[model samples]
Target chain A: MLWAYLHCYQLTLDTYTPLQQGGSADEPTVVYHENSNSVVQMNAAAKQHGIELGFGLAQTAALCPQAHIIKYDKDVEKQALLSLAHQLYPLASDIVINTEHSLAIRLDNLLQYYGGYDVLWNTLTHEINQQGIHYHYATAWGIEAARVLAKSQINQMLRERTAITKCLAHCKLSYTDLDSKALNALEKVGITSIGQLLTMPVHELGRRFTNDTIRYLTALRGETFPTRTLFRPSSTFKQHTVLPFEVENSQHLLPYMGKLLDTLSHYLRARNLTTSSLCFEIQLREAEQQVMPVSAATPFTCATAWLDLVSLKVERLVLQQPAIALTLLCEDFEPIEKDTNDLFSDRFTHLAQKQLIGRLKAKLGEQSTQLPALGNSHIFEKMTVYQAQGNGQSYGFDAAPTFLLDHPKPLSVASRVCFGPLRLQTGWWEENTQKQDYFIAQTPQGVRLLVFKDTESKWWVQGVYS
Target chain B: MKDSLSLFNNHPNIWRAREQPANTSRFALGIHTLDEALHGGIPSAGVVSIACTTGIGEVSLFQQVISQQRKHKLRVFINPPAHVCAPWLTTQGIDISQVLIITPDNDADALWAAEQCLKSAACHCVLLWSKTMAAKTARRLQVAATHNDALCLLFSLASKKPSSLPVSLELSLKAHEANLTVDILKQRQGWPVHNLSVPFSWTPDNHAIQWAIKNNKRKVHSLHSVS
Candidate 1:
C-alpha cells in the first residue's frame, strides 16, 4: 500500500498570525501564550533574530524587540485542518489526519486514475498553492514512515523499504514522536539521528527506553501499523461566528451573516451537495434567540442566491434585541446534479425564474408561490390543487381561471348571470356533498363573475374574474 | 474598465431605449385597439395605471393579460378585490399553478408585494388594485418592473386622480351601453386619445336588463330582482 503524508509544518504560526494581504513574509513573528508564559511558535525570520519557540514572552521580547506576537487560536487551526481534509477527500482513496499539523492519505488506488504519482503530485501542489497554504509532502509504503519523512520536509516519493530507511537515516531525532527527556537522554548518549537510534538492537532499546519509545521507533520504520481515525465529512452543517459588535438592527447584521453563508457554501461545495432550506439564528444579549428560516423554491448551491434570499429576510426582519452572535444550520442536504444546458435552451431565463421564485418566497413568504397540478376529482376545486413550488412538472389542463376563491360569497338578487349551467358536483362519499351548477356571469354593473347555484337553490358568487 | 465605462457612457440610448418589441418581450393586452394604441403592445416592463369607474371591465382586461402571459411565466395578483374563480380560470386555459393571489392588509403591504413580484422576474405580469398611491411608491414600483423587465398594471377605482401619476399608460375605463369605453388619459410618447369604444361581448340576462332599465327609469326608487 502507498500512502502520502501532507505535513503542514507552519500550522501553528499560520493559525496564530494569518498571512494578511500586504503583510511582509520576512517580518519576525512569534506566538506567545500568556497562560503558559512562553512563546509557542516563531517564524524563520524570528529564529534569525535569536528568538526561538518555547522562550518566555519576556525573553522573546528581550531577544527580538521588533518581533510581532500573536496568540494561537486552536479552534481556527482545527477548522483550517478540517477544511483542507475535505478538499483532499475527493482526490484520495482514504485520508486519516493523525495530528494537528499533518494528514496521511492512501494513494495507491488513485495512482491509476490520476495517471501516476507525478500528475497527482502536480495537481495537489497546484491546489495547495492556489489556496495560499504552505505544505510539504512525502510518499512511502506505510502511513507512519510517510508522516516521519514529511515532518523532515522530504518531498520525495519512496516505494521501497530500503530507500525509505536510507532517507530516514538523515532525519533528526527531535522530529520523531519520542518524549523530550528521552530524546535528550539519547542525544547525550551519542544518538542524535534516527539512523543511530535504529542501529541499536530492538531488545537493547526496549530495555533502555520507555515502551512508547520502542513502539514509536517500530512504527516509524513501517514495522508496525499505527492507529488513526479516518476523517469523514459531517452529515449536517452548523457554523457559528461571533459578530464583531452588538448589532441592534438586522441591516447591520448582514455583513456578519454574509461571512457565515460564505463558510457554509464552502462546506457544501466540498461535499457536492445542495440544500433547500437553512435555519439562521441570531443570539441576542439578554433576549430570546431569533431563529429565521431562509428557503428556496428549488434546492440551490450558489452562494449568491442564498445570500440574496437571506438578505431579503434580514431586510424584512424586526430585531427584538441586539444580536451578539449568529449561527447558520442546514441539516438537510441533497446530492446536487450538475445540469448540462443545451445549446437551444436559454440559460438566463431558467436562472431568472429560479431567482424570481427565491425572491418571492423570501419577500412575500413560502405560501405566496405555488405550482398547479390537475387532480382526478369531479369537484372543480378538487380538480386542481396548488402544490408548493419546486422542481415539480406543471400540468397544463383544460381552460380554467388562474384564480380561485377561498370561499363562495352569496350574490345580491340584482346580480345577473351571463353564462350558465357549467355543471360541477361531487363529494358524495364525504359528509360535505355538493350539487351545484356553475356559471361565468356578469353583475348588473359590468363586473364578470363566476357564480354557482347549490342544490338548495341558493345562488353564490364564487369569485370575480379579476 | 475605462473602455467599458466609456462605452456605456457614450451610448446611453443602448440602456434607455426598448431593446425589442417582439411578442416574447411585449404583453398583448388582448384588445387590438389597446395594443395598437400602445404602439406594439403594453411594454413588457413599466407600470400601466387604469383609472376606472365601477364595472368598467378593468378586471376583464387584467384577466385577459393573465391568461395570455401564463404561457411564458407566472402571473401575480396583489390585493385582488374579490376571490378569483379557479375553475373559471381553468376553463380559460390559464395554468392555475402559475397564478398567485396576495391579499395585503394595507397600501404599504400591497405596494411591497407588487414591487417584490415585479423585481422577482418570476411573474410575467403583476396586477395590483389600489384606491390611491403616493407618488414615491408608484415610482419605486415602476423602477422595479423596469429592472426585471416585467409588467405591472395598477387598477385604481378613483378616476379623478392627478394626471401626472408615475405610469407608462393611464387610461380611464367606463362601461356604457354594453360597450367598454377606453379613454387614454395619459400615454408615454403619444397624444392623449379620448373616448375610444371597445366592444364588450357578454350581454346581461334578459331579466337583469329589464331590472336595470326599470331602475334607471325610476332614478329615485330601488328596484329588486324577481327571483
Candidate 2:
C-alpha cells in the first residue's frame, strides 16, 4: 500500500539534548514504544510527564513536563534484549528483535503450550511491563510493514498463523506485491490504500514495482513466510540480557551477570557437567563487541570454581566506559566423572595427604618442603648426605655392618681406650681432618653397628644393623 | 649442574608403588634408636632431613633405602649437588636402571620438585639434596608420608638437631672398621635406645656397595668391655 502512516508521538521532545551537552549519550526524551533511532528518547520534563515513546524532546516538554529523561544506550538495550531471548528460547521457533523494545516471534508452534494466542500475549505483556516498560505491538506480513504498523498503532491485535497473514495482507501485501516504485505512477494517479492500489493490474504492479515487493505480496498471502528449518541447537552454553535503555558502566552489569550465573550453574548441575573453560562477550553500541576467555587446569563448577577462574582473567579489563550488553558462554566442558574410594581405606589417605600438603605449602611455601636423598660419594666427608629423592631408599641399612656384634646397650669400656682396631684417616687435603679409631661391636641386645673412637679417645656408634 | 632430578624426567624408569616381601613394605626403623638420635630417613614424600657430623655413613644409608625400595620395584630419583659422586649409591646395591639422577643448578628447585613428587602420590619415594629445612615443612612431610603410605627422606648438613621430630629412628654416629656405629637415641615403635648401638657398614662388590651381611650371619665375635 502507498499509505504513509507515521506513528504520531512527540518522542524527540523527551528523547535527546543539545549534542554539546550530552555527546553520544545525550538525546531527546519521548521514549518511543521501541527505541526509534529515528527519534530521541531522553528529553527531561517530557519523560517525567509520561510523554515517553515516539516523540521529539522539543515537542514533548511543550505537551507534558516533569519527565525524567535518559540518554540512548543501544549497547545495553541489545544486551538486555539478547539475554531475554535466551530465557524465552524454549517458547518459540524464531524470535527476531525489531528494536530495543520490540520483538517479532512466530507463535504457531508455542501457541498451544501457552494456552492460545491471547494467553501468550497477556503473559508476554505482563512480563515486559513488570520490567517498568510501556509497550505496544504490531503485526504485518512484511518486516518493514510490521515495524511501521507497530509504531503507528497504539494497541494492535495479536494474530496467529494464517490469520496473521490475512491481517497483514493489505498494507504489507500491496507494497510487497506491486512494489512502491511501480506504484509511484499509481501515486501520481492518486492511489494510496491497499484497497485502492489493488485495482491496478498485476502486470502493471510487476512492471512498475520491484521484485521484492511482488515476492513480499505473495509471502503475505500465506504462500511463504521465509520458512527456516527448526533451529538445530549447537553444543554450546550462552547467556545474555536486554536493557530498556542503553548503559555504559561496567559495574552496572553485575546484577545482570549474577542472573546469568544462576542460570548457567543450574544448567550445568542438571547435566552433571563441569567446565574448565569459558568465554565472555560484551556488545557495544555501534562498534564491534569484545570477547574475553578464561581457562582452568581442571574441571570446575558452581559459583566458587567459576569465580576463581574468572577473577584471574578479569583483572585485565581497561574499559573507559560501561558495557551495554554481556554474554557468558561455555564452548567446551567435561562431564563430572565419579570416583570410588572407601570411607576409611588407605585410598582416602591421599586426600588427607593433599590437605596436609596444601596446608603446609600455603603456610611455609613450596621451597621449604623437600625429600632427602643419599649423596653419592665414598669419602666420609663426601658420603654423609641426603638428597630429596634418595631413590626410594632406607637409611643406614644398606651400609649396615653385616656382622651383628650386639643390640643397643651401653658398653662400659674405658672412656679413652687406645684401641688400634682401625685408624681411619681420609679427606686431609679436602678439609676432612679426621683421626678416628673405629670398631664393630655386638651389644647385649645383639645389635651390630659401626663404632669409633675420636682423636679425643671418646667412643661412639655411627650406624646401625639392618 | 642439572644433576638433581626427580622421576618425572621422561627417562625409562617410572613411578611404581612398593611391592615385594610385602611385610618389608613397612620399614620399622628402630624408633627408640634412630628417631631421637638423628634426622629421619628419606621421606616417603616431601623433604627428609639428614646429616653426618663425623663418619655418619650418609651415602651408605641412602643406598640401603634405595636398594630396598628398588628390590620392590620402586624407582629412585636422585638430585645431587656437583660434589656427589654417583658411583657411591650404586656401590650400595641401588640398581643402576632404577636410579635417576637430576643434576640441579638451583638447590631450591631441586628441593621443591622432590617434595612435589612425594606430594603427588605418584612415586614410591622422593629425595632432595639439601643441608637444612624449616621445621614446619618437615612435619608436614611426615604427615603426608603417613597418609600416602610412601616414604620421604631429606639430607641436610648436621647443625643443631631438630628439637622434636617425627622420625622413627634416631642414631648417634661413630665409625669402627668398615661399619657405621649407630647409637640408638630414640625409637617410635618401642625400639630400645640405651648406651648400646647397631653395628652397620657398607662393603663394595663389583661396583655395588651394600649394607653388611646379616648381623646373625657374620662370625660370632663379641667385644667384652671394661665394667
Candidate 3:
C-alpha cells in the first residue's frame, strides 16, 4: 500500500498567529520551546533578520529587537494538527496523526477513485493551501519512508522501488528515525549517508547499533509495516483556546469566541448536524471559571447566527475577573430537518420566529419570554402555565376570566352578581384546598370580575373578565 | 417655483400624502358599527393605538381580532397588565401554542421586544401595553410593523389629551354595561366617528345563572328545615 506523509513545519507559528492580537502581518515572530529555550519555528520576517532555528532567546532578541517571541505549546500544536487532519479528512480516507506536527495518509485506496496520483496530489495540495499552513509532503511505498522523506524536506512522490531507493540514498542519516547514539556509532564507522547504511547488511550493522535502530532501518526501507491508529472525527465538539492577553471585559472575548465558533461551524457542517446550545467556560485569572450557556430556540449550524446570540448574552455579562482562556463545549447534535414549503410561500418566517425568541431571551433573561400553555387543574390560578420553549398543548376550558391575578384581592367596591354560585370544591390532595363559591360580579364602574366567597364568608376578587 | 416644487417632489425622502400608497387590507373587528366607522375595518398591517382603562372590556373587544390573526403565525403580547389566562385565550378560539407573552422589566425592553416581534415577520400581530408612548417610538413601531405586514396594537391608559402619534387607527374605549363605547379618535383615510356602541360577546351565561338559582333553592330549603 502507498502512503503519503505531511509535515506542518510551522504548526506552532500558524496556530499562534491567528489567535495573536494586534500584530501586523509584516511583523517578525518566532516560537521557542519552553524547556529548551531555543527557537523552534520562525516566520519569514524573522528568518530575514538572520534568526535561525535553535537560537536562544537572548540571541533572537539581540538579532531583531522588535521580534515577537512566543513560547511553544505542544497541546495547541497537536490540536491544530488534528484540526488540519479533520479539514483534509474529506480528501483522504485513511489518515493517521503521526506526530504533533505531521500526519500520514494511506493513498492506495483513494488512487483508484481519483484516477491517478497527480490528481490526488493536486486535490490534497489545494485543500492544504486554502488553510494557509506551511507544510512539506512526500509520498512513498511505506509510511515510515514517506514520513522520513517529508521531515527531511525532500518533497517528492515516488511509486517505483528504484526511484525511492535512489531518493533515500541522498537523505542524510540524521533525517532517519535512528537515535543520536546510533548515529554517532554509525559516524564512527564511517557511515554518513543513508546510501551507505543501506549498503551494509542488517546483521553487519546489528553488532554496532541497537535492535530498535535495526527495526527502524528495516521499516524505513519498506521491509516492515508499523501499526498506527487511524484518525476518526470525534462525535462531540470541544475546543480550548488560550488567550495571548488577558481580556478584562467580556465583550472583548468576542473575537476569540468568534474564531472558536467558526471552527465549530465547520465541524458541524462536516458532520451534517446542528446544535441549539453551546457552553462557554471562561477561565478567569483569579476567580472560579464562569460558564455561560448560550442557546438558540431552534437548532442551527450557522456561525454568525450563533455569534449573534452569544453577543447578545455577552453584552449583559459581568465578568468576575479578567478572563485568560476560553473553552467551548457542545455535546448535543441534531440532524438537520429540511423544511418543506410551497413554491411561492415565504420560508423565512419560521426561522425568524425562532430567532426572535432567541434574541428576546438573550437580551431580557430566559424567563422573560414565555409561551402560554394550559395545565390540568380545576383551580383558576393553576390552569394556565407558561413554558420557555415548544408549542403548548391545546386544551380548551369554558368561560374563564380574561386575566388571572396571582394574589386575590379583598372585594372593596359594591358589585352586582351577573353569573355566579359555581362552586369549585376540588383540590383535596393539595394543601391549598379550593372550597369557594365563584361568581361573575360586575362593579358600579362597569368592570366585570371573577369574584368568589370563601369558607369565611369573605368576598375576594380573583380575576377580571376584560 | 416649478423647478423647486419638482425638486422637492423628486426627493426620495419627501412624499406627499396623496402620493403614498393606500393600504386596503383589513381584519374585521367583528363589531358591525365599529367596522363601519373605520371604513373596512382595522388596517391589517399598521399600528393601531387604543386608549382605554384597565378591566373595561377592551381586551375582550379585540379577542376576535387577535384570534383571527393567529393562522400558523405567532401573536406576541408584551407586558400585559396581568397574567393572561390561557383558558380565557382558549375560550376566544386562540391557539395557546401560538401565543407568546413577554414580561419585560421596564417599558424600554417592552418596546424593544415589540419592535423585534413586529419586524420578525413571523408574528402576525403584536399587542403592547404601555402607559405612555412617544411619537418617535410610535413611528418606529409603525415602520417596523409595515415592513413585515404585521399588525401592532398599542394600548395605553386613557388620557384626556388626544395623541398625535402616526398610527393607522386610534380609538378611545369607554365601558357602558354590556356594550363598549368606541370613539374613533383618528383613522387613516376616513373621518373620525364618535360613540359607536360595540356589544361584548361575553354576555351572562344563562346556564351558569340557572345553576346558581338551583343551588340557592337548595340552600334555602336546608336553612328553613334547620330553623
List, for all models, the DockQ compared with the true complex.
0.22, 0.03, 0.59
Rank candidates, DockQ, best first.
3, 1, 2
The TM-score values for the models, in the order shown, are: 0.69, 0.39, 0.86
Candidate 1 per-residue C-alpha lDDT over A141-231 given as tens digits, one digit per residue, 9 for 90 to 100: 7777787788888988777778888988888777777788988878877888888875777887777788888787777766777676789
Best candidate according to lDDT: 3
Worst 10 residues of 1 chain A by lDDT: A393-402
Q: Highest DockQ among the candidates is held by which one?
A: 3
Error of model 1, residue A76, in angstroms: 5.3
Better of 1 and 3 by lDDT: 3
Descending-TM-score candidate ranking: 3, 1, 2
Q: Model 2 RMSD to the real structure?
A: 17.0
lDDT of each: 0.72, 0.48, 0.85
Task: Write down the lDDT that model 2 would get.
Answer: 0.48
- What DockQ does predicted model 1 obtain? 0.22
- Candidate 2 chain A lDDT trough over 10 residues, lowest sum: A1-10
Tens digit of per-residue lDDT, candidate 1, span B122-154: 777888988778788888988998887788888
